[model samples]
Target: MMVAIAQERDRAAFARLFAHFAPKLKAYGMRAGADPHTAEEIAQEAMVAVWRKAASFNPAKASVSTWLFTIVRNKRIDMLRREGRPDLREEDFLHLEQPVETQDETYEANETGAVLADRIAGLPDDQALVIKKAFYEDKSHRAIAEELGLPLGTVKSRIRLALTRLKTTLPDS
Candidate 1:
């Protein structure tokens, strides 16, 4: 019934499709290391693709679940590729600006640092340590693990889990 309605480009069919798969797709994104907001966006994008491509769906060739999962997987891969590519704007030196060293600026900078430090301290010790090593020390997970005498998998898992927890705990933008 849904397949026939979707084949005919019914709006209700699309809505039903989104209701059924969006949560599942978002879960998939979360498992793939994406934050909840990003996961929701990816799921919506995948559903839109499903709506647009419904005419091409062949139930005999593949189930709707398989098609939806494939779309979500491809979207995630595309997002990762986009993130791995350096931003051209950042690469261009024209956008760079020198900071003004006024008294107010110095005070603001110190306050910002204090706030950041407090936030980091509030996190679990393991998470704080991993984040510090990755960002402050600019070290790779493998290097950090070796330096700490920890297994590489343990380090990676800790970081991933920390990020997931942070995603939920941090205030939404």
Candidate 2:
């Protein structure tokens, strides 16, 4: 009957196949934990797959029942996977807002930054360079050592001395 449907587009063959397998497929879905509506949907989709894939079926591989059951199982898995995903909606995005700083906060931040830069400038050249690379340029101490061709210990010492001097001079935040 599958071969007949594949070769001739036989509606009678398909009707017989659907009639025999639809209820069984639906029951299989329910036994596997689907609700009645979902089971019915799975059965209908599986039968549609059978009709579309009839040309690809091989009797040597498995019987028709095995093939139909496999299609139904796959369709059930696909449905479950789709159901597990969260649906996106415009309302879900409406609550998120980008932070905006007020004018006083922005001025305070700029003033603090300027004070920090002035304190760093007061350090000796080597200590100031290390501090700038480590904090302003965002380089690691080891990377600063490599770039400056200084020993790792020398780079670390420079950063420590710079921080100690700045701490003594700067007011507590």
Candidate 3:
């Protein structure tokens, strides 16, 4: 009955559909290794898609549960692909002109750098040192190792772990 109404774009049916399946979608995301917050966001997005696409749903070909889970699964795959892709490139900067350094812009840039430094400081001592050597000092991993009296592999791993932790902590730029 709800599915029929949803097929007709009934708002109440859509609300009922969301109420029933949103939690299951979130649980599915959690089981797929997303954090709880991320799971909730994924679930909400999936349900919103369901509402928008309900008119196309074919009950003869698939159960509502199967259709809904398929949406969640597809969204998760898309998220993984996006995560695997490198969205930013250093070479992309070559095409852009430098910003005029207004007083406000300069102040904001300094403040942002200070905040980033503080965040880097909050990392484990080894991680912080590796980040500083590699990024702040603009040294290559091999050069960082030679400077720090550490093996190249160790420096590489430390920098990688530091970057992962930093990504988890930082707001999206």
Candidate 4:
């Protein structure tokens, strides 16, 4: 059906695709915190993009549902950006100021961090690698699994073990 729409520009194929995905996309947007009206707009915009950009879709990279949902997500972000900031008042800035850190406090933080890094280095290579990817590099367990060609459960287990080891080794402040 997608191939038909992309290669032949078949309206029938597009109609069927839109019918199947539009409501699901709207529900997805709502679940992502969009109001009903915004969710509807997101669904419409995603369908329009599918009609326009169908040729760019690659089955090997993502399934049709994934592609459609990605389009909906992008459309929602664009709409939010265009909407711009809401009206702001003085109260909005009340919590903006952060207390300055003392020199001794900053030095203690750096020492603690160095000790933690050393402890992490002492872990088994697999556990250390997963811990660094999950925390320092801010990658999800699923992403780490994909990148390392490991199972998700293995990635998660390594992180859990690394955290337990770190907790035991680190002294309480």
Candidate 5:
């Protein structure tokens, strides 16, 4: 049914998929510790993902529910992170209310960023790899673990240890 929607743009199949799974996805998000609004967002995003990525679905590998709940889980994380995230403004970094009048300020900013990069480079290889993958590459810990074929706990431990090292190494700001 979902594959039909993907390949043929079948609204009825999509409707059926939405009717069956949106509520369940919402409930799953709530059980996973999201509030109602976030749960609704996750359900909505997951359904959209089902529509967009359904062509990739293969019934032989996994059922629609398996595929969809996976999408829901990821969507929940993304939505909650966004809701809690601060809006990053240029002023927040440059410490200026308006456009900079000096190029020296830009140079200083780049130099400070370089120093931070040096500190990251100083971490142990395992710790630095996890930090880069998680922050720079923007991959989930589970994705990192699978890519590296390491246990999830090992990946998490590396990230935690790396963070602790960074916290101690970087001067308090």
Candidate 6:
């Protein structure tokens, strides 16, 4: 019967399935402590999922009842959690992040970083020291000038010149 629904999308087969399982699912939800209306919704949701996922059902793995009750069981848990977690957003869970880094991106980052380091090293000592304080040490331009006993404009100029030289000198990968 499930195979009929999967192969043919037979409405009669679906109707028979619903007739057999819907009430039982509802009763199961209620026994699991969902309210009456929630139990009804759970049964309907489980049946819809079964109808849509019918093609995925494999008799080789599980009996029809076992597979179906599993759906009902999951739906019941979802309903229970829904009641408990009113703040849950469906959209928040719709997309999952792929955390794997591609080989190309990793290689490019390492190469670019090495080029940047070499470029910074090639800068004049005064410019390189100011740039290092402003960027690497996260010092403000005024603070860098005060600490080095130089004028603010001189510190800013050094940083600007250092950046322009690095940008023009670094190899674009």
Q: What lDDT does each candidate get?
A: 0.64, 0.69, 0.64, 0.68, 0.67, 0.69
Off by over 4 Å in 6: 82-173
What TM-score would every model get versus the actual structure?
0.47, 0.47, 0.44, 0.47, 0.46, 0.47
lDDT of 5: 0.67
Q: Write the per-residue lDDT of candidate 5 for residues 1-173, one digit (tens) a residue.
A: 65568799899979877876788788777765677997888898888888887777654444344456457656766766655534342111322222323223224334545676787889888888888777534478999999999999999999888887666532233
lDDT tens digits, residue span 1-173, model 1: 23544566788767766676688788777766788998888898888888766666554444355456567766776774455533332111222133222333224434544655676777889888997777534367999999999998999988997777554532221
Tell me the deviation in Å of residue 154 in model 4. Answer: 18
lDDT of 3 by residue, 16-98 (tens): 66666787688777766678998898898988787766666554444455456567766765664455534332112222122
If both were scored by lDDT, which would come out higher, candidate 1 or candidate 5? 5
Q: Which stretches of candidate 4 lie over 4 Å from their true place?
A: 82-173
Clashing pairs in 4: none
The residue pairs found clashing in candidate 6 are none
Count: clashes, candidate 5: 0
| Shift in Å, residue 1, candidate 4 | 0.7
lDDT of 4: 0.68
Residue pairs with backbone atoms closer than 3 Å in model 5 (clashes):
none
Give lDDT tens digits, candidate 2, residues 27-62: 777765678998899899988888888877654444
- Residue pairs with clashing backbones, model 3: none
Minimum summed lDDT over a 10-residue window in model 3 is located at: 89-98
Q: Residue 10 in model 6: shift from native, Å?
A: 0.3
What is the Cα-based lDDT of residue 98 in candidate 5? 29
